[model samples]
Target: MRANLCSLTFLLALTLQITYTTSKHLAERPSFLNPCDYNGANFDKCFADNFQLLFSHWHDGVPGLKSLGSLDPLSIKRIKIQQDSGATLNIVAELENMLAYNASKAIVKKATLDKSNFEVDATLELPALYAEGNYKVKGTVLGLNINGAGKCNLEAARIRLNFHLATKLRDEGDLTFSDIVSLKAKILEIGDFHIDVQNLFGGQRDLEATANDLFNQNWRELFGILSPTLEQTLELVLKDRFTKIYAYVPATYFISNMPRASEFYG
Candidate 1:
């Protein structure tokens, strides 16, 4: 949920690009983030709603925050994956242009926030998520030997992710806490990826054709075995970018005035 919305903030940092067109600037101290208070009635829904609103307006970068730029062609210096199968399957890929489409169309269906703890759990759905990238890859998977670089395209038709992510909070007291975002996301499902990777085996016509056939035929199993590596890879990407974006904003900016523990009991 939040993961889909994550494009614009840690959430944004993931997608990392913008300009806030609205007169209400995100830099307006207390911004839209304040109402996300923990003690506020229906605050969880409040947070979710706000996330969706902002996602819809993602093209407009937050005021007073440095633009992290667009999510399209998200760059990846490299991804190295090693899986234990009958024979080790290892893949190392470097992508300069990776397109993640329709990120702004993400819907945060539900969000539960613990502002004080800097935690959020949300369910996010995106109708269509399609990506294509130019890749240089070196890897071996299944019984096939794959070594080469080529073009890769992926169609993750519909994406549904349950995000359990936390921010490292710095307390400003009085229930206010700084965003201090350090993101670690747990993705429940990324949906099915209909994909194609070309030019493997250095164009060994026989092996290349066979590998392509195998990829199309055994994609499900491959993804199952590779999901962990994929998740870890995404986590690294998000964490690095999230930190870079948040670095410019003062920690206090994300502070939310939440009710103290005593309020609920007293």
Candidate 2:
């Protein structure tokens, strides 16, 4: 009887151990914020929450342009978004351009109505975006024609923007764009027109070097002359993006228990 009791106790302990190990593994697996297990009912909510979390980081990273004194950086005038098979977002905001300290102070890059332009419409192929469990945003400024009072007709200017975010442990996706693109502009009549090739290169290098500098500086306020209409194409693979799919679809197995006869002798 003593031996039999001991054997039963050992079997019970083994069973408990197996259960604990399996449960722990399941818990550790990576899961989607809103799993697509139940159709796409929760897709929208999941997308919004994930996007905000991702964009917040980007918004915070970009230091406020101080060329416009005491102006709010987060004040975006117009925003438009459209999601078909993919998603497209268009945003319009005032941007300030700063000048070097040695430059003229009278030429403060003050904010002007002519300096405030809109992002031109552009189409982005969303399907090309394949970073599941990730968010990717790309933008480009085209046809930047500077037409205003002082130093107008700064023709043939261009700007480009690219953004990417991933929640997965590893960054896996094809998120690269072609190096070469085009820009076109028409020179308009305005203030003195002077082309300073050296100043242009110097200004760009300075901005890159002092990317975080913002306190006391004079900069030119340039409006977003135009932006291409936004077009986006995106592709998502839910299972591959989240590792939790492996746990939910575990391998099939059969469990069987055979009866054993035991006798207690006096």
The RMSD of every model to the true structure, in order and in angstroms, is: 7.8, 28.2
Would you estimate the TM-scores of all the predictions? 0.70, 0.17
**What value of lDDT does candidate 2 attain over all alpha carbons?**
0.19
Report the poorest 10 consecutive residues by lDDT, candidate 1: 1-10
Which tens-of-lDDT digit does each residue in 1-266 have in candidate 2? 00111110000000011111233122221232322211244433433343232123322221221111111112212222221111121222221231111101111111111101211112111111110111121221121211111110121122222222221111112111111112222222122211211211223556422321221121111121112211111111111111232222221100012111111010
Q: What is the lDDT of residue 245 in candidate 1?
A: 40
Please give the range of 10 consecutive residues that has the lowest summed lDDT in model 2: 7-16
Evaluate model 1: give its TM-score.
0.70
